[model samples]
Target: MKNKIFFLSCFILLSLTSFSQSISSSPYSLYGVGSLYDSDFGAIPSMGSSGIALTPSNFINNLNPASLGFMPLNHFMLDVGGKAIATTYQSSSKSEKRNNFQFSHFAFAFPVTKKSGFSVSLRPYSSASYKISDLKLPILDSNESYYLTAGGTGGLNNFDFSYGYRFTDKFTLGISTALLFGNVDDNRTFTILNSITNIHKKTDYNGFRATIGSQYKIDSTFTIGTTIKLPTQIKSSKVQTVETVADEVLSVIESNTPSDVDDYYMPLEIGVGISKKFKKALTVNFDYQKSLWNDTRQSDLYGDFVNQDRFALGFAYLDEKSNFRKYWDRIQYFAGANFDTGYLEIDGKRVNNASVSVGINLPIENSLSSLNISYSYGQKGRISEGLIKENYHKLSLNLSLDGIWFVKRKIE
Candidate 1:
């Protein structure tokens, strides 16, 4: 049964890779590097992405690398996941709906020693795919307005490497290094009276960032964790083309000109989490994170940066009595909620998000291997003049497989 499950998971992983490039689209993606992505792995998605203090004895934990230090000896773990989203975008005047499917992440981990572990992963960091047509806005210092049309695509990818070391039976420390790289393509058209102008640009970006984390076990059934992400800058360069047309005449101001642009700055972030168990069958997890974007002193053409806060809470339940004869006894159930005070401020208003989710982990065999499925509904932004709101439903699927190594069969 284990071998069959492993091969089936491998097939699904390969099939999903082809859709990895598909990205969710949003008008908010027009800002910064695109909409920031959530690539949580395993049952973490079902738990509202609140697993920073979880032990990694059965599955990989992407939130806090320090959790890796607790990996069971001689065990290798693999995780892969994807998401499907259906969104409704609304303005005071109209509403539109869209659907998207995209791959989330791929990761693997293994113990390096009895007291240490290592892992690596690849995932998208952001998505900048959006389209806006015939948006009317007043010209600066003038009552007259211009009509604008714009579209963009592309974003950044993250490659991460992490290591954890256990200092004692109850304490662990870890570090993670991430490489961010990608390019964005944008085209905009503006019509003011009789004259029309068009601009096309492609910007490339690259950067590196680091995070440090620690976890401490308060007792047999309680743990706490903390993580700090350092600030960094992403360098950028762009190639652009500009043209104008008026009175049946066309003019090219610049053609494929290359130049350096302002670098994007990432702010320092801090997070804390706790996990507690009750009666050996129920578990609760909670997390809070803060991003000091205001300190970055960054402003966009359409928005401003502000400090951000995120909160997540989750609960899980399972039967404590093991019954090999009953498969349902091994299943686990989870539910969670999350809220974010976003970092983007437009017209003195902050965009925010709130969501609730529920899911289950279905055991594949007698091991820790399982298939995770989750559903969530969320709302982002608010309905107001000059701003849009988004209501979305998301479905997440993940496969986690566990294997043992370095042990020989006695009967063989």
Candidate 2:
């Protein structure tokens, strides 16, 4: 079991190092640093990404790191997963479709003591991939027209570490530190009378991020959790190049060496959640999250970064009285839904998004391992606001493993 865990870890690290590129292709990603990546993993994805207040059990909950303090002593857990996405974009008169597949998340957690724990993980911070070429304008007072084309790719990555300590059987606190780094590439081209000019820009990012979390048990059946992510800026360098195109041939006309740009701002975020258990047969969770983007004083060229909020409700159920001999009877079923007022303000309206999800956990034959699968259908933006609308379907898979890391052995 240990060997298998080690192998999986190495494979994920190698894959991440070898394939570094954008994982999404939505036009909404063109704003700010790009569309933000989901921060939850494991069965939580099936549960509307809302497990912040749940006590740790077979799976590790990273949504609220403080929950780690409840892990069983000497227990080690690991989760690795990925997702596949298909999306269709629609405007007032046209539509396009795109597909993508990419690694989702990787994490490892271990208990330091009966009341303390630690964990580490690697997850995507954001993604940027888009192409636009539908603009045409008549040359001033001339019978000629020009076209504008724009596209971008690349994103940011986050490496995080967390530690949690239990103050009592009912309360826990945790802190997390993250190293953020990545790069983004943006390009634009203008064409007129068979002549084309292109401008390309690249930005490299590096920064540190921090967060704090806490959880308090209100009763045997209810618990409350909260988290706060502090605002920080990412130091970056930008490189620009200009090229001229004629007769299908291109030549670089000018270029700017990479130079430092004013650091980009990241907004503060806060989240709160609650979990309720009903006699072990069913559990329900509710979560609310907010990003204070309006206070960041940052604005995109085409839109404003406004305050963002999300609400989610989740449920899990199992037949506790079912025979253990039946594999299907022992399985857990989960379902959820979420709604969001997105961070981008375009055409005087904030982009809105919503999704519904369902999933199940399949237990391994003779090991403390389970395979989790989830599916979600979502939509973003509205066609009535002079904006593009996006509809997407996503599939996610995760392998959750539990084992003992070390113990004393006795021999005769």
Candidate 3:
């Protein structure tokens, strides 16, 4: 109880010390919020990635309780998923970059109530990990040149807890909540073509999150589910920022006092899905979801104006003689497709994008564990009517461990 109180107190203290401010600044992009939470599940050609509203039969979604209804009885679930990426910039000769190990997430789940369960998970909310360096044309009014190199990593390390109850043999209700311990660390080097200054800032914000959803069996052959997510608020903090004036020299600004000003809101997300059983051993699932991104606002630095709406379809089948490992055979394959259009507008202009993803379940450790790998590639274009696009590729691998942990005793 004392430890609990201490952690809570620490969170509250951080909440009261941070404030968010965006002056016309390039490092401002560091303040850019929201894009890092996109979960593509690593399947690119079929189920489009990008946090679209869909759930395939995978282990990671349990971070939000809406995903727990899919687990089986006597089940103990464990998951670790990570990504590798190769990013290329096509417009500028100096734009090429690579981040082989980009992001990762971990999760665990187990039964708590009859036909009900609970779980916890942690994952990167939005990655501040990036580098930006560009030279501007001569300032018409000033004789100075602008060159800034800055980047940061970390945001909203989320911890989730959830409970799911079976209301009937065919229906289940799920409610899950999350507590985020956010830290965005940054370092910047600024220059006016000669003089340079380097500064760093680390800010922490703590907040609460929640999601409510339910699943129902339409018949012996099909099932469906939906969830409504509540918005999460990250307490304010004074993060490091740069302010550019007509003089062209970059400068760091701080609050006159320790101010609780920075606040981040993860918009409400709503989603629905359905699964059909084609045979005793074959089944298919499909889902659609929309996140309230338009309802969220951004600072000049957090440029992802695109909140997302997504769609997906996944399938599972039992293998020959059920020899694929009882657990591994339960998930034969998964495929999906997604579409994305963000809320980012450049003076009354908006651009749209889409993609596909696919993955397979490879059984491991006598079926007690399995390795699921997925790959995705996509493009979002029409940047501010300049037709700028970010064509990207991502590969992901997730390991799932599921089995029985305890057994109840009976007496005559």
Candidate 4:
């Protein structure tokens, strides 16, 4: 039975992987590598993406690797998730709507010993899919303006391996290593007066990064955790073609020219979180994270990089002593909220985001397997001159399944 389940899961995972490309369509994705993705696993999406101090005894926790230290003995776990998003883009002149389906993440974990665990996961790191048409911009140092049309596709993917060890009953430490790789293709058309120019480029990137985390239990009901993400540079190379049309005559300036480009720098990040339990029925989690984007000294053509701050809070409830005959009584309910002071600043205005989510976990049969469903409503950016605002509704579904290993069955 276990072998059948594993093979079935592998088949589904491959199917989803083929359709996971182009998960984002935000105009904001035109900047940097693209819009960063949130591929939180299991119930983490329902918890406002907050779970730094949580243990992975019930579900895998991607925010902090230390959570794996508490994995139940002799248990193997697998988690897969996906999302559907509907968004409305609003500007001063018009509004547009788009919908997308995203393959969120896939992971599996197992215990190495009584006090240690390890996991491996694969997920998208960013999305570079966007489209813009006839955007007018003033030419620098001139009274003239130009019309610009741009489109891009492709993004980065993250493959990570993590390990956690419990040194004592009250403390755990963990480490993670990630490989980031992908490519982006962009095409742009510029119209200045009667002259037209076109540029098409494809850039490839690859890099490695590391993270360290620690968790400590203050008491039976309280826990605290911290994590540090080291900065790294992504190596980049590009092939570009540039052409121009003058007096209705087309001329090629560069044809498939390959060259080295500036390497992209990822900023250092730090995070802290706390988890508290009230009796056995309710749990609360709060987390704060900071990214030093300004310190990286990275500048975009249309925006400035600034320090970023994020906060998340979540609540979960379940009835531990409810009647066993009532299925609803065994279900877990969750609610959460998140706020982010974005790292990109355009026209002296910061692009920010805020969101709230609610969800439930439904158990399957009598095993440690369940389905997680969540809904989120959020807003990003703001309506202003040359700015677009996004209002989105997202639905997430995650399946978590666990199987017992290395245990003898009494009857077989």
Which of the numbered candidates is closest to the native, going by highest lDDT? 1
Give the Å error, residue 310, model 4. 0.4
lDDT tens digits, residue span 254-362, model 1: 9999976889999999999999999988999999999999999999987898999999998888867667568778889999999999999998999999999999987
Model 1 clash pairs are none
TM for candidate 2 is 0.89
TM-score for each prediction?
Answer: 0.96, 0.89, 0.73, 0.95
**Per TM-score, what order, best first?**
1, 4, 2, 3
How does model 4 score by TM-score? 0.95
In angstroms, the error of model 3 at 248 is 13
The candidate 3 region of ten consecutive residues with least summed lDDT is: 19-28
Error of 1 at 105 (Å): 0.4
RMSD of each: 1.7, 4.0, 9.3, 2.7
Candidate 3 lDDT tens digits, 373-399:
677776655433222456667666666
Candidate 1 error regions (>4 Å): 1-15, 322-325
Model 4, position 16: C-alpha lDDT score: 50
* lDDT winner, 3 or 4: 4
Q: What ranking of all candidate models by lDDT puts the best one first?
A: 1, 4, 2, 3
TM-score winner among the candidates? 1
User: Comparing candidate 1 with candidate 4, which one achieves the higher lDDT?
Assistant: 1
Give the least accurate 10-residue stretch of model 2, judged by summed lDDT.
13-22
Instruction: Give the distance in Å from residue 57's predicted Cα in candidate 2 to where it truly belongs.
Output: 1.5
